[model samples]
Target: MKTESTDANTSDQGLITLAHGAGGRVMRQLIESICVEAFNNPALALLEDQARLDMAEIAAHGDRLAFTTDSYVVDPLEFPGGDIGTLAVNGTVNDLAVSGARPLYLSCALILEEGLEISRLRRIMASMSDAAGVAGVSIVTGDTKVVPRGKGDGMFINTSGIGVIPQGVELAASRCQPGDCVIVNGTLGDHGAAILQARGDLALEADLVSDCQPLHGLIARMLAVCPQVHALRDATRGGVAGVVYEFAEASGRAIRLFEDQLPVRPSVRGVCEILGLDALHFANEGKLVAVVPREAADSMVAVMREHPAGRDACIIGEVLDGPAGSVQISTLMGGVRLLDLPIGEQLPRIC
Candidate 1:
């Protein structure tokens, strides 16, 4: 291991500032003194860059399984449609789903601040259990640690998930091509707006609830109809722009999106108009943008609309071959413009 260099005398500050990534002696002390003691497991004790997950338990005769991990620290710890507990489970499962896997089991890690209500923790745990049951996954193991009140946030959750990817189900980003159609499951900006609303970040106020829900069932239905999907990406962090731009860059193509085709709820548009945030750039937890071949576009949309998760689905754009890796939008008034990636944090602590 590369020994981190730093002078001693680090204090328990109130926030998890950039110091956590300083990678110096002070950082090691933080991991050892708190994180390590909380999650003192033999496998994790090895402490390598990547967690070496053994598959002997879930392995069958000749099966290859998938493994993924995610962390959750949404502000307020609770939100309109869900709290942090359901967030952790659904987030991890969605990661596995986009990877073309059926989720099976999970391991959880918790960092709790001192003075947190035990009753609140119980509620979160109960929510997690119910969500996991609904998703058909299990929480096999976990670890917990308590930081001094000022030194930690209320609660942070980390989950590592494992699943199985059956044969002949391939989904990748680099498969997009010119003339392919882009589709979205439902409305956007719900999760991001809800998070912002909960934090009181916007000047105007209205009831905004997150669109956070599971997508495995929807994804499976899409795969059933058009398993030849060029790509499938959940519009989570940076929303549809981030995922579509990524596909353009990865596939060496340009994206042309029609403004009217993109779905935005009236509630979200009203809030964004007052707050000065683009609903397109807002994050969505339960929605996805799928790139499908033109030949299957109409049929795919028909099938998607039949499913509850995709009833509001629409073809938002088409891939093009001009000026590679650029995203162009055809304005509602018959003009064209390039959409740029958002700079700086718009809403903080939003999943």
Candidate 2:
């Protein structure tokens, strides 16, 4: 039951507390100390309710635009390979890339529980600054809310992104055609496994780390080599299989994949085996499922592997004119299996 600052952290304001959201002294300190410092900008200087952006010109190019928003609520707030700060930045970037858009900017919203450690908050902010710097996207606007300690997680971040779709690149699952080769950007399940390992909630052990990273650069590089890329999707939640199933259903085609060609890191496989989770269905923060024309698959893959985040990229499967939206796996044991989506959360709180 921490109280909001009757006096600001500085002489100008008091320490922040839950009562800040009550529209009083506490809230002002939270805004001035945390919010104002982390997201200082001219557009946000006025502290208005709504944001007015000068992005209307990007749509006049006779190309469609893409808008997406997501919330990151992973437990522990920190993980082995990355913390939520960089994770939030890269996550939003990858979303725009997979949608065939060139990500330009992002808006961040943070929810802080009362009594949160100021040190932890500072570290998260620093990580976010570095990540945003690397991804080349600006955090133009943001909002902050404080809740009672038990009312919410220690910290929650929501990011909304906007990007301009390039002309002549219509990448959607419906555009997937038979004979299109399926390409994956890199090893799978690293992000989810890394979070779980760091938490010690799974009671299993392995040297797994999250693959969370910004993939927009890699996607841009690949597009420069070949824009005929039918579609691009980041393997986040629902993992590689989820993205493939989405394309199959959207295009009314069957996606056939081979186990041998699928990229799985040694650490990922070892962790999943101990935890009884399927690597295919686990999450990947820094990978993608790309659909390339059969003739151009090799070149695209080669280009992807040249990038650090795409070293293990592989061409794992192809689309076929079968019962649309079905994902079939050819196991290394010479048996075929259907990869139906999991009914419920097999690994809850896995990131």
Candidate 3:
């Protein structure tokens, strides 16, 4: 076994090793040379144990702080439209965004497997930096650890984010009311379909790409026009169906969705048809579901359409008075079917 001092003196051989996580010179160098260089912000440069934030600056954005965290272990880290790095930043940003917050800062933690290429790590770090820039959030502090090659995958990322919810911006599933309009920003299931195809588990071909993007900006635009928006959720993991179910359960109201209004891309629809899947249940990283009073629905959608992310914005459903805590979908065949949450994840590690 190599002594700590000896390991600290050794240089990186273009691959990650256990020494990189030993909390010694090697670990410090890895963080300073790669992670710090990628995210060169003042707060992160301090190299403090915890990020020192300006409370006054935070207070200027809103009265309450909105915080969220998520982990990404998506198989085949790099997909068509994004990679695990992009997902790490955007995922946490969206978590705060859906709560009507202005996403601000993020903390990244990496678990790397030994023998991973240094070049790959650099590329992933750069991706994370770029994604933070796009989301207008700073990566303030982070930690890194290396595990044995077989003990971990290529890498896993965990991101925690903080934002501020402006005054009067109270959003929750309990606020959903009957007659409220349910709207989606864009096509659903693109991310899930893209990941499925990227995995190359089946001999399938489709021009699908992950819709993994930061939704905070688009959500801000929606809230600016319609502050009365009741509930908002990024349709991830369990997808739109999952979000609708949450709203129903929280508000004790029924949600009815119109199948025809759901905007699903042709490639995604094709993938679903070939695999016996429903686009409604597929995961999406960039899409969101919103519930707003009927009076504000049209204007809200109009504003949403003005943004790039919401170009395909449309109302897909409405809150109903019958059958509390139930979600039903009106299929194109003029038949209604209960849209229940999946007992098991259709696409594991999808986000």
Candidate 4:
């Protein structure tokens, strides 16, 4: 057995042994070198069991709090554009942001498998720290655990976030109304396609990277242009089609989507075509689906295109007056097709 003080066991070049999770010297070393050093915030610095925040500071933003939690178990751990760490941060942040909130803080929990490389842990931690900084949020608290080899993937991350929704902003699925324009903020399916390629499951390959990013800034920009936005959802696990179907069911209205207007990257489209999959059903990490008043549709798309994160934004659909709780797509081939909720999983563990 490797001793805790041994350089071979504690160094970054070393592998994470079960001893590293025992809540002793080795565990403390791992936490300090990777988690503490990387995240480096006053709240995290305290090393307390839980993070404490001033209620006054939180209450100043809004009367409501937006809280969300997500877990990332993407295969390959590291992918073309991001890793599980980046995914964990961006996923939680986007969830809060899409609900019309200003994201503020996060809690990170890591599950590491025994025999994993210490360097990999460091790299992921650095990625998480950088992602949190980019989103203007802090990793206020975190926990770590280790599982036996073969019992777990390299690493899994769970992040919980809290944000404040500014006054006068109401966004929800039930807010959808007839004539509301459905808009998508940029190309879809890059994240899912990228993950599939990363897993080496498909023989064909093209340049694809996960569209993982913080969407708070983009959401804020859209709200500034149209505060009356009915609903906003980050199309993640279920993708655009799932989101539209959800909107239809929640609002008890029909949704009509223009197939030609949906922005799809050529590479992603090719991959989906070859794999007999629909890009609309694949997962996305950075894209958003918005339902806004018809009057603000053109203005929303125009403003979205001006933002870096939304340069490819466009109107893809709209809500209808009747034939409630269903979605139909107007195909580019001039035929209308009904879109149903995905019956089973298309891609598992893509996120």
lDDT, candidate 2, 9-69, per-residue tens = 4232223367756766656665666555665666665667766667565666337777889
* Model 1 residue 228 CA deviation in Å: 0.3
What TM-score fits each model?
0.82, 0.91, 0.96, 0.97
Report the lDDT tens digits of candidate 1 across residue range 254-340.
999999888998989988888788888898888889999999999899988998878999999999996889999999999999989
Off by over 4 Å in 1: 1-63, 203-205
Of 1 and 4, the candidate ahead on lDDT is: 4
Candidate 4 structure lDDT: 0.91
Alpha carbon lDDT of residue 69, candidate 4?
90
Q: What ranking of all candidate models by TM-score puts the best one first?
A: 4, 3, 2, 1
TM-score of 4: 0.97
- For all candidates in order, the CA lDDT equals 0.78, 0.80, 0.91, 0.91
Best candidate per TM-score, number? 4
Sorted on lDDT, best first, the list reads 4, 3, 2, 1
TM-score of 1: 0.82
Which candidate, 3 or 4, would have the higher TM-score against the true structure?
A: 4
lDDT of 3 by residue, 1-351 (tens): 122222333333478889889898778878887888899999999889899999999999999999898999999989999999999999999999999999999999999998887777878889999999999999999999999989888899999999999999999999999999999999999999999999999787778899999898998888888889999999999999999999999999999999989899998898899989999999999999999999999999899999999999999999998699999999999999998777999999897
Off by over 4 Å in 4: 1-8
Q: Report how far off residue 234 is in candidate 4 (Å).
A: 0.4
Worst window of 10 by summed lDDT in candidate 1: 1-10
